[model samples]
Target: MLDHVQIADAIAESLITNGVRTGTRLPTQKELGESYGAPRHSIRKALDLLEKRGVLGARQGSGTYVLGQLVDYQISSRTSYNHNVRRLDASPTIEFLELRTRQATPEIARGLGINRSARIFDLYVLRRSNGEPLCLARHYLSEDRFPTLSEHLEVATGISDLLRRIGMQDVRRSNSSISARMPAKHEAALLEIPQASPVLVLEGRNVDAKGVPVEISTSVWPASRIKVHV
Candidate 1:
């Protein structure tokens, strides 16, 4: 006799074999119970476990839905999301989540080579591929270098394009650091993965021709879907 946990694993396997994908609703508790020869309560428990593992999600007043695997992302000093998406023949889009002016923290100052408490422009962006969320990025730009940055840049404009348009040509990535950890509650919600899912973090700096740091970026991607290439 299979336990609720075992039943849940079996259901997950069934989902893949049946071609069920992200956003595909699973059968109702009663139906699952009947199919698996288990009690309704056990079926619910199975679903709950799956949800905690980020394999499924239960929406209010809606049925539980399958949560698909994370999208793969490649990280490198020369990483260009636009180019990568084009190479993969996937539609890529960027969504601006927030923009604000704030004083830089010591860490941000170090990354951008600015003084602590210096004014900076913060831009939060969500990058998607084929309508699926992929990564969340936070950008810090030195206000002194591009005072009118917020007014000139749009959500659709790539960072490289923005630099060229603003007369900051020849900008290149100066440094990047990578790390990994489980996602936080809010981050998990934004990425539509379970809270226990791991995320890859990349911290990078971009410099102009003079080698002066102009921008600092920190992005988090789903670890399950992305691999860091050097």
Candidate 2:
């Protein structure tokens, strides 16, 4: 009897050999088990392992489907999600989840160089490629510095666009730190990944031409879907 690892390897090879198209759903666990001469439990474990490896994705109440190629995302002085996705011939869109003013925490205060508990504009957005959720980003901006930020966001395309509209022409990345960990429940649901799947966390601060911190952001990406290039 083949173990789960070996079963997963076999299934992956079958997918490639059969030229299974991306987004094509696989057979049910029982069907796969019968075809592979393995038990249903072993088939389930193999599916799970394949999902974690980014070769497949499981949809709730649906079935497992083949995933697309990994996206190459570059980190540089000026990193734009839209630009990056477009460079790979993919359509990119941003969904603004929230825009609110809130008191800054100790970490936020330090990142933005503001007083603790200072009011800041909390901007939350979900970015997608070809309608597939790819990243969740949260941006903190000092409200006092840009009192009309909310107004601009209402009509602007994105953070960078709004900043330019408000007369910030020269904005660049000042610093960045990358880390990895398993996704949280909410994060997993939002990014449409299994809770057991790992995610890449990017924390960074953007500065203006004057070298003053303008935006402190935290972005989360599904590790399986994204390949970060520093």
Candidate 3:
């Protein structure tokens, strides 16, 4: 089943069932090979074809994972990141930095499926593992859906946490794109990295349990330290 097509389909189905949306990361090719009894090279070919079909992606050191946002009732895996980190001898903290209203930019609007000038709810979150910055997230919400967005500031930091808080019980990501690029001067300063350092950029849009686009988020990670698992 590790051939070009079979393994790819297997991964796709597995992801779909697990609620691993697009732009989510998958297991490493080596892990896939081990799991499926294929050579790494063959596993890589399967991944290559999946990526071509917009179903898989590799994020530098983060290993291979899903490629785009989440799809339908594909219930995401019931994994608790906070618990996992604590089990790994670390703590998790979600800092409720702040939220505001802003007009979406041309790029933001396009991803959010809105007019380029639509106003949206903007959120800033700092996710720390063991009290060290692990992921910095900026989320954009279709304000029309959650007019009371600002009132939900004290919720957890993880994306799933926020989704649950909004009563979006079945929210799932349908597409996401993860890329790495040199950090901007400001981002570099904030992440405590050199300007030349590259940061991992993740773009994700999630649909509600009803499959309506309700949230879009772009997260930045300092490439040197983060281990991204989609």
Candidate 4:
């Protein structure tokens, strides 16, 4: 007889093999036990294990559901979010939330190699894959360098495209650091995940062909939705 751990492994594998979509409600405990030919207690244990692994989630008074497969996102010299999603045959979209000029903080100044209190363009955007929110990004760019950035960004396709239009032909990530933590209330709501769920924070600096800092970006991603490849 299979133990609870074995049953959990089997069910997880089945979910992958069957390509179960995220948010798809799973079978009841009774039905799962019958299908797995396991005892009810064993089925319950297996479901608990899966939930802990982030492969499944339970809704209050509802039922368990598949959490979906993790999307592979690469952090490389030339990282493009749209390209990454497209490589997986998924559609990607970026929605601009806010754009304005603001004084650079000490941290932002250091990231952009600019003086603190200098004017900078602050842009906030939400990234989505297949119509599901994937990440929220905050971008900082020197206002002096791109005075008309706001006008271009309002109609631009993405950051890369906007950069190209502003005469920055080559844009690349100079450095990136990743960390994990529980999401804030607004972040959880935006990502459509539970507040208890963790999120991956990616801090990245991008440069032009001349190696001059162009943009400082901070992105938050749902831990269950993406696997970062460094």
- What is the TM-score of each predicted model, taking all chains together? 0.70, 0.76, 0.59, 0.79
Each model's lDDT comes to 0.78, 0.85, 0.67, 0.85
After superposing candidate 2 on the true structure, give the runs of residues whose Cα lies further than 4 Å from its correct spot.
1-48, 52-65
Compose the digit string of candidate 3's lDDT tens values, residues 17-86: 4555334556767788898888988888888876654455677878776544322221123334465455
Candidate 4, 1-230: lDDT as tens digits: 88998998788767654546678899999999989999999999999877865678899899999874446788899999989878767788889999888899999999998999799999999988778888999999999988988778667888788888888888999999999999889988888777877788999999988899999999999776676789
**Which residue segments of model 3 deviate by more than 4 Å?**
1-87, 155-157
lDDT of 1 by residue, 1-230 (tens): 67988997788667644545467788899999889999988899999888776778899999998775433345565667777655556677788889899999999888888889789999988887677787899989988878978776673366666667778767777788999999888888888787777788988888888888988899998764454565
The global Cα lDDT (0 to 1) of model 4 is: 0.85
Stretches of candidate 1 off by over 4 Å are 1-72
Clash numbers, per candidate: 1, 0, 20, 0
Model 2: per-residue lDDT, tens digit, 1-230? Answer: 99998998788777754545568889999999998899999999999898886779899999999885346778899988888878777788888899999999999999889999689999999888788888999999999888988877767777788788877899999999999999889988888878887888999899999899899999999876666778
Candidate 2 global TM-score:
0.76
lDDT of 3 at 45: 87
Q: CA shift at 219, candidate 4, in angstroms?
A: 0.4
Instruction: Give candidate 4's error at residue 212 in angstroms.
Output: 0.5
